[model samples]
Target: MLIKSVFIILLVGLFCQTSYAKDNCPTRKPVICYWASWAVYRPGQGAHKIENIDPSYCTHIIYTFAGIDMDGKLTSLDNHNDIVNGGYKKIVALKESNPCLKVMLAIGGWNEGSEKYSLLAETEESRKKFAEDVSRLMINYGFDGFDVDWEYPTQRGGIPADKENFVALLRALKERLKPRNRILSIAVSASVAVSKQAYDIEAICREIDFVSLMGYDMQATNATSIHSPLKLESSDPDDRETLDQIVYYYKSQGCPTQKIILGVPAYGRSFTLQNPQNNHVGAAVLGVGREGTFTREAGFLGYNEICDLKRTRSDWRNEYLERNAAVYGSINKLWVSYDDPKTIVAKAQYVLEENLGGMMIWSIDTDDFKGRCGQSAYPLLQAINKGLGNQLPSSFSHVDF
Candidate 1:
């Protein structure tokens, strides 16, 4: 009887431990999605409003972006009327549906450039003012936190002091937000050359909750190569361009695995083939391909547009490169390199294996919100959720580390 009781107690302890681990997994590994503010105005895409976002699909949604005024203050990038009357309130209202959802306001982006960020981070006074203004903006607009998307700190048109200044700025922001229990995150370059020169990663990581690694665009626009390949092909010149190399680079740089979020593109890079017959991986390209129906970018197509082409265009051929673990589509003289459900699943598995924080999509608005893709709306996002085990029976909440 004594031995049987001891065995029962051991079984109960193991069960409790398993349940606790399961419960903590989703909350600890966040699935952060970015929502671009400009998608509402794309000519043929129609307005993608904040109301359309399904809160359950993402653990956190970053609104891109709020700009920096000349005086180094945070201001809305969109029209004031639209921000006040439409986007701002509707975004905060999402919490009503999913109280676990965290909404963040991202400041600066590729076009915004780094000049203003360099200026703002140059001095203690400027950093303090910027932090205070950001804190106020979050409180006023009901944002849960802030995301700094400085294109490049020391590069671009920024000053040499940007590397140090950026760290100071993060510390200042953290000081203000910590009191309110708010979150702070920064988007950093995934390129080894750029990231090494532009950021003091260890110092910066200490001040923020997570590092949103811009893992896409490793390949140049003029080049005919896979933009976000998981592994380098034999023909590839730079192995650093691969996703595996980028993640390992950050990990080696002293970034805690839990504080690093791998970025996935919701769109693909397209290149016009010099010869339609030579539609292989490293074929030469004349220039950017035709504009997407919705995105309207010459060399870019959102997942929805890609899916539409696959469904309607007979010339469209989807192929997966086993060597790179990436998917690319070809149609006539155009080829697009993008992540499909298969690549997303592989990336999700990598995230779990490495114990990384979670996966982050560039912009949620580019997703197939209308279900026109035939695989259901937000299929890529759904893949990430499934990959991360977010659909498991467990409670998720705003977790800070």
Candidate 2:
């Protein structure tokens, strides 16, 4: 009788342990969303606030970006918005609605440049100081982790030693964050040429939670082309790089497939054709396309801006680069290449087929969150969520256009 009782207790304990492990482990792939703080400044319909974000749309939200000072310490670039006005506090509060959602603070961006990050990573003392400063800021602000967006470690005015030092910097940050159960991730360029010069792929992969591959903005030359293509388009040169080639290159370099998060753009790159009739890809371009009313930046248009153009105008011709898995629009002299819901779904399916970690949106702010284009709100993100085999929560199940 005593032996039987002991056996039963052991069996129960084993079952409980197994159940606990299964329950704690993440069952679905992550949907990482980046929220740009600057979107608050956009006028009228283009302005995106912290409240506009749907917590259900993302598994992880990264706030970009917190700047690094000359002293190698983490600092808020926009104090009035980020700290004084409770931007960080409000974004972190999203966890109340999404218990599984992880929020991280990103440091460095294209505007911040690479030289500052290079100098910061050049010494152990600076790296240690930066890591500690990051930890304190995260702890105080309730951020779950840190995201390093150094652009490219060894280029953009950065030194050659940045290749090894980049890995060292991540190691230091990882060591500091691990004890607190926090995470660390990086955003890396997708270009093979750039990756070769900037990263020690295998080493960097081993240290961080995942690599966010900037799969967009990879136009080969000044010629008008699809900014982000899943595969080489029929019109593309044989040597032109695509998202497919980018993934294969990273994997061949020893980065695990599951550790790579494919980036999807929520904006489009635009070019002004020299002749309105010559609006196809590889056509001649005189300069950047005209800016949007809200975004007000030449050569770029938010998905919201693009969709507005499509909705209000009747003359624009839209085409899907079927072979490449991308889409484009041309009206008069304006040519813009961007991803729509259909293409976003295609990318998400590719994510599952390739066993990638997840999808990372360059930003959620640029998406048509208000549903002004006569489609469901967050159509692109919704496509990604559903394509990844997950359903929207009961609260947001009723999508509005």
Candidate 3:
């Protein structure tokens, strides 16, 4: 009788713990931060490693760009493909060093997402196959879950029926992963597009674990004005997406309040155009590169190079609040886009106001102030963490500064 009582108590305790973990204010809230290796990572290329990482601030690490398969499925090329290429081992090493950090592999990005997602969602078989493939991919590489970076759900001006299909696809992902506990999240834009496309926003919110909002692009690079305003009162005319606005969109659509995570960009965009008066009006890039193309292809500068310039060169200046930091100074007559510390403060406040899920940042290496060529990486990422209320998980608390 005594043993039975003890066992029952233990079971109750376990259940309580599980319930808490699922709560918005779980004793240990997970602040998921993403890192892109495919575009910027290379063996020994980064100056830092997992041990050097300040895990206290970031609870999850998402390795982006494993690429989608020929059949429109998400696949992992980290462990299977030339592992040494994209800091795959370094990422694995980060996980080993930080037990509290749950790692996931992200597939698809803005440019290469959801082309056939609608067609795949049409048939149940296709959805099941996609789920099975995702499970295999995660299990094979030892990841906790998958991050779906589908740029937009509905039409990309290419097709008109992706809205409903997007919801069906999430439902299928949830169904297939039911037996096995895994994470599923969708990357959503902060524009009015969600409402326009007829994306079952309420349904998408119901099926997925959390909604990740890309709220950084309110103002692009270049131009002349406040870009990503944080706390605007409408009548206040501050600028950017307000927390209340974000909450209204999700809540109106019936999305769970606590399950939404706001995204803040670790890197900023750059642009230069003729009339640099308005922030949004599409401008010409004065730098070597142009917008919409890869940095290398565009011929201006890549991430690491930019970082080096920020440090080694005094001429480099970032006008964070102006939304023209990357083009802070005109080399003659031109404009650019990017943020500095001033804007990050507002971004963090938005997270607090809505009581959203968490914050996820773009490619970590790009944020390194030193460009991996100088002293320890600084500034960029640390600023973001500081902005988010510094709600670091206990597991990473012991992490060094």
Q: Which candidate is the best by lDDT?
A: 2
After superposing candidate 2, which stretches have Cα over 4 Å from the reference? Answer: 1-26, 396-401
- Superposed Cα deviation of residue 61, candidate 1 (Å): 0.3
Q: Candidate 3: give the clashing pairs.
A: 221-337, 222-336, 222-337, 271-335, 271-337, 272-284, 272-335, 319-325, 320-340
The candidate that wins on TM-score is: 2
Q: Which of the predicted structures, 1 or 2, would earn the higher TM-score when compared with the native?
A: 2
TM-score of each candidate? Answer: 0.89, 0.92, 0.73
Rank candidates by lDDT, best first: 2, 1, 3
Span of ten consecutive residues with least summed lDDT in model 3 = 323-332
Tens-digit lDDT track for model 2 on 306-399? 9999998999899898767789899999999999989998999999999999999988999999999865788888888978987655552222
Candidate scoring better on lDDT of 1 and 2: 2
Write the residue-wise lDDT of candidate 1 on 30-71 in tens digits.
Answer: 889999877877766545778778887888999888888889
The per-model lDDT (C-alpha) reads 0.82, 0.89, 0.58
Q: Alpha carbon lDDT of residue 331, candidate 1? A: 84
Residue 169 of model 1, lDDT score: 93
